[model samples]
Target chain A: MTDQLSLTLAALADPTRRAMLLRLAAGTATVNELGAPFTLSQPAISKHIKVLERAGLISRGRLAQTRPCRLEPGKLLELNDFMDHFRVVTEQQMDQLETYLSELQAKGTEK
Target chain B: MTPAPLTVSRVFKAPIALVWAVHTDPKHQAKWLSPDNPEGYLSKLDFRVGGTHHYGAPGPDGAIMYGTQTFREIVPMKKVVLVQSFADKDGNIAPHPMAPTWPREILSTTDYEDLGNGTTRMAVTWVPFNATTVEEATFEGARAGMQGGWDHQFGQIEAYLAGL
Candidate 1:
């Protein structure tokens, strides 16, 4: 079975779906409401919603009138946690290593 | 089946000796380990087979999360194999504070090659060490999901979208 994180990232790679998730993050939205911001058709919006639902980024409620899509904060937070660690590995460390290595090279030239 | 190890490589304009020295030296390590926050991320290394480099990395929540890297093999400037894990201040292996499901020990190999042009190519290959199925899956997902610059945009969009 495919993991949830990989699915979430793939679902997020699309700008339209990212916008849809952003809208849902504010609050739950119906399919029509989600597609209102973009010029996509109902089927197209439904397709994106299906991807988000399958990825567990959003959940569809069985409300009688409209099945609203609510953001699943858990998966998104997991991605965020990964990003935080990624930042430490990148911003806090490797860039500095590069600079230090270059400085050592320069110092060796001066010696 | 074993998944392919995640490898990250970089080539530096310095010689292999300097590159290897920086990798093994504690003083040099403390300098760049957290270049912006010297006092935040602490580094103390005992470089030898089975020796450990215990350090604290600043967490996202403003806490210092400690980690330890134990040397499994040190082949001088050619290669160094280490087991990396989260740890307590005393350097005992521990679960990650925020991500407990993350691999407890990651075996990594760092190889330094002299390109004969006064440049050194360093490659670090990482794999989960003695990890559970879930832990291995976690590492695999993290490795694949994070291999992009889109992560930054995701953060920014999340911040604005979530109003956090």
Candidate 2:
């Protein structure tokens, strides 16, 4: 899952790729369709789709002669889980900090 | 319950311009933003009103954390408002997968105040927008933990700036 998330993030880093994701989220489309708004060639769009497929964020299936790409929500779930881990670590540290601060106040009062 | 707006405010001993530069410049931002991301990278940044920024960085365990923001308001050295979301491969906006409860979009605002004494006060606020019941609940539930994460991130920025 972590491996998948890293791939997804790396793939999504580019604005072009992120735009592709947005279009795919709306509905599946062919490489040519994805390229239309960006004014890129079909081959260029295909490359982006390939990157996404490698990241497991999307998959391509042949519909007739055209290869249509579809968004796979599962990998996104994996990435979200990875981000949530930070929340856990942060809260634990905060708990420890609060305890230490209270102890400091107590010691000061004792003095 | 709709969560109270989540915020992370920090005071930095730098002039407002310098701090705003750090916040707005993509290269400078990549240096200290998103501390959880060890290899922070800002892929695309459009700093004007209605501009968009796409950012990605390697998480602690080596996964990439990617997010996008669209600028809605921009005021020189004073305020910036934007809408942010997670993006999928096609650059399409997506929601947090695991937190199906999370709002699909977050409205974020950052205000900078010149505090004199070479210091700048920054306050950032985030709130869910047009969220479903689950999303709103998830945001409210995660508030405390999110606050903790932001606190750590601010500390990281302070340290990085101090080291410079």
Candidate 3:
């Protein structure tokens, strides 16, 4: 089985799924409501929802006869954490490079 | 459809020659390439077109992860373009250890612009290389989420989540 991180990334690999998440970010919506913006069938939308749900990116709740899907921020937080590492790394590299260059220049001046 | 390539840029207070040399030199690359840890080392670096660069370090749970970059173009002191891939210790192409669906290869270009007065502007751009429809969509989605429109939506999501 793929790990949670991999599953989350795979769930987010689709434009339709991402669009659905964007809509949910504003507010919760039913399967029909989520499917309204796209030319997808109910079953197709449901499949995408299942993928998101399995990745723990969205949660479905029952409301009378309809099921509304809400975005779960926790999974996204994990993704943010993963991406932030790269950002930090890049910043650190740039800083180190600056220092390295300064030291190189200092040596040249001393020679 | 192909999406806009992800790009990041920075300006360094150094001459174009110095900046370019630091970037191309393996010794300097080893100092700054890995984001999380400096202990990870580059095993091989062939600084020429048609050559390959390999680096790896111990990953979570005792698994050593490897990265390979096959150089396609090298314009000294100006640009370097390469195809990046995950690889095994033997340097054979492999799926990314964490995200298997991640693009098998990414085309990366690094450009250096002379800013005069001993300063240089560097920009790095990345895009999926000959990706499938699904891979292309995935790359586009990830890039958007990280650096484009989805970035604003993410902020909204963060605020909404905080309210919950």
Candidate 4:
């Protein structure tokens, strides 16, 4: 039972999948359209697309007969939220260090 | 391939000696190293090379989440390097409580640069230590996604969200 963040990071680990996401960022694209830039075969591209879809990074829309893949901004926001944890930790630690230094200085002044 | 190290740098308004002391002293370490609020505490510390520092705090559900860092190098007032790992309450190495796939150990190197004028610049670098191929790949993927592609994706996502 992989978490959403683990799935998202695993899906993003591949260069080919990242390239597909970059292409989808522009606008919606069909399977062939998404695979146009890559030399990979149809099934290979499909596999990459499936990973992205599973991770909720992209979604496919049924427009008539053509299924167009579009980027899902919500998943990107989730990824951002995950990374922000480290930022918050770093900031909080720095704040605590500042306070500690001030207390040390105050002790030195009293001596 | 190994991923690029995650690096963070900051300048402190204190002297290099004071900054180094605060970082190495277990009493001072207990004051700031905890990530979440003030719920965590450093349970044990040995401020010497080859010594280990074990710390933990109660999780939201009241379970203890422990971590350890073994000192590898200590340069007085200048640098410190350590290998960090998650551990059980008994101080034995254990899988991360939240993310089992997280690397078992991370090598952390911190450099203290004296900028003069009672200020010190601190830079820290973190990399997976003795990781398996899968762990290395995961770290590489995260670094690639976070470092180079984040800003571009953020802009696109913001615009896309605004349009919705």
Among these predictions, the greatest DockQ belongs to 4
Q: What TM-score would you give candidate 2 relative to the actual structure?
A: 0.52
Off by over 4 Å in 1: A1-56, A61-74, A90-92, B37-41, B57-62, B148-164
lDDT by candidate, in order shown: 0.77, 0.66, 0.78, 0.77
Query: For all the predictions, what are the DockQ values?
Result: 0.22, 0.02, 0.37, 0.42
Please give the ranking of all candidate structures by lDDT, highest first, separated by commas.
3, 4, 1, 2
* Weakest lDDT window of 10 consecutive positions for candidate 3 chain A: A83-92
lDDT of model number 2:
0.66
lDDT of 1 by residue, B1-164 (tens): 35447777888778899888886786777667656566676788888898889988665466777889999999999999999998998889997555566678999999999998888888888898998766775666566545544445556557754674
Q: What C-alpha RMSD separates each model from the true structure?
A: 6.6, 17.7, 3.8, 3.5
Q: Per-residue CA lDDT of candidate 2, range B1-164, in tens?
A: 55578776767656787677666876655555444442456477877887888877555566666778899999999999999888764457876654443567899998999999877787878888877655665565455324544334434433433443
Clashes of each: 0, 14, 0, 0
Candidate 2 Cα deviation (angstroms), residue B151: 12
- Considering just chain B, what TM-score does every model have? 0.82, 0.79, 0.87, 0.83
Model 1, range A1-111, lDDT digits (tens) per residue?
345665665576566887787677678888889999888888898999999899888898999778888887788887787667665674446567879888877887799
lDDT of 3 by residue, B1-164 (tens): 77579887889888999899888777766555543455665568887899998877554344566889999999988899999988999888887554566678999999999999999998889899988765665566567667766667777777877888
The TM-score between candidate 1 and the true structure equals: 0.69
Query: How far does residue A61 in candidate 2 sit from its true spot (Å)?
Result: 52
Candidates 1 and 4, the one with greater TM-score: 4
State every prediction's TM-score relative to the real structure. Answer: 0.69, 0.52, 0.79, 0.80
Using TM-score, rank the candidates from best to worst.
4, 3, 1, 2
Position B132, candidate 1: lDDT: 76
Off by over 4 Å in 4: A1-3, A22-26, A32-47, A64-66, A73-77, A106-111, B34-40, B57-65, B149-152, B158-164
